[model samples]
Target: MQKSVRLKSFELVAGDIRDVDVELLHALSISVRWPHRPKDWELFRRAGHGIVAVDGIGRVFGSAMWFPQGDNFATVGLVITTPRAQAQGGGRWLMDQILEQCGNRNLALNATHAAYPLYVSLGFTSEAIVYMRQGEVQQTLPALPTLGGELNELPSDRLTEITALDERAVGTNRARLLALLAKDASIATLSRGGEVVGYSMRREFGRGFVIGPIVAQNAWDAVHLTAVHLKNLEGRFTRVDTRERDGVFAEFLQRSGLGVAETVTTMSKGRRFLNREDKNPWVYGLAGHALN
Candidate 1:
């Protein structure tokens, strides 16, 4: 039997991401060691538009997706290129297609180390560093700050109640994306004087549940908001993506056993995506790397 054979290179073409099989997309992500399950891929497909690089035989080699939030902003994610294609500039080609499709909308993305230079060269400037924290939840959570307001679980149908608060933190109206996430998420809101002040959502993804989109007025508030979900998730695998590099909130996460697993740079192509203010609602946790 022949030990090896070199195959000739072939032409590739752009194809609609929706037209590809979910299993193929799953395989593509796995090739790059991404943690997206097929369900996650389906959720992404439903939330945005994307394109895939394919060959004559319909094999997918790469993919790039963009989720539009309102008319002026979008987040790019799920950019992947098979090992065999990366050397040939497949990643850049896929991103070019996404940029063209995005039109005039501002863009943001969480860039892995390998892709950082590519995004920078394409005009994306760094904004912040997101720590990808994950681990088995500690059996006993660290002592939380004194409860300052009512922390209540909100029915997903009442999603509208928190859209304004969400926008205040995210800097854009992502009600549509939040509605889709609500379909499978458990939401909690912190209210003071009958006014919602902070919120968090927990949903299944990748290797476990992710607690995110946590919006709050301070690190203490962020701690309580996240603790509400952690209390119920003890001993389960969980992840939280946040730009809180250091502070009470970051300390809480670290002490709770959700150590930093990796870090990604948040890059933007147009208007600034993050505008944080002291004592104002800010995103303590992100919705997702791609959705940010």
Candidate 2:
């Protein structure tokens, strides 16, 4: 399809799809391959969802979904547009559909350097800055805090506690989106006695891994969980995208031998979701973009 010089009219079809090939999606030039492979979309679709865009011929051009989070918050993510379908109202169409469906939640996205301009133009504001780190694994990392929190792998029956804790740490929780979170492999938790405190999750990002929703007592709590999780994968060079408030996590990353690969501005549109009272923190690692 030829790019439209100007979109005279735009249309969007609102719905959900669980199976999106992140590699194929990137191959279409809808996204950049920071880590390609659709690991999280399955879970996002299983939860609650929002919008998808299709051309007049009824083929998917690009897509976006507004995922539900606890505390009545929602996040917009899994956004993509095909190269053959670019500039012909695909992006704008998906945007309109998502904004309308998002319905006043504090929407969030871990944006790429290329897409920040479009996000700003669409009325999303950066709540925090994120710096991505790439390349080889460092030989040493900051020690995990003992912090008196008992650590345990999440059990299948107790996932609700983990999800509930996620809402407490972050404004929203994407527990409903990915079925894998409920699975034994991708989940871990930290607590005191039986009381749930913090949790961590990992999903394959292309060939490597990405850590998210590493919720904890605070930034320190989350970082502790993050390090413990990363330690399990010490030899792998994983990509971590975290929303920064202060320089705490960034410093921790630097000490671990990681550098700032890229900086992203997390933007939101519509009403600000007010689940968490405090604004700033050291840094926030996403559980999943679809979940916020």
Which candidate leads in lDDT?
1
lDDT of 1: 0.91
Clashing pairs in 2: 43-177, 43-178, 44-177, 125-267, 125-268, 213-286, 213-287
lDDT (C-alpha) at residue 249 in model 2? 68
| Error at 252, model 2, angstroms | 2.3
Evaluate all candidate structures by whole-model CA lDDT and list the values in order.
0.91, 0.60
For model 2, the superposed segments whose C-alpha errors exceed 4 Å read 1-26, 29-31, 48-60, 70-72, 84-88, 103-106, 144-147, 173-175, 178-180, 274-283
lDDT of 1 at 284: 93
lDDT value, residue 39 of candidate 2: 47
lDDT of 1 at 264: 100
Model 2, TM vs. native: 0.75
Error of 1 at 118 (Å): 0.7
TM-score of each: 0.96, 0.75
TM-score of 1: 0.96
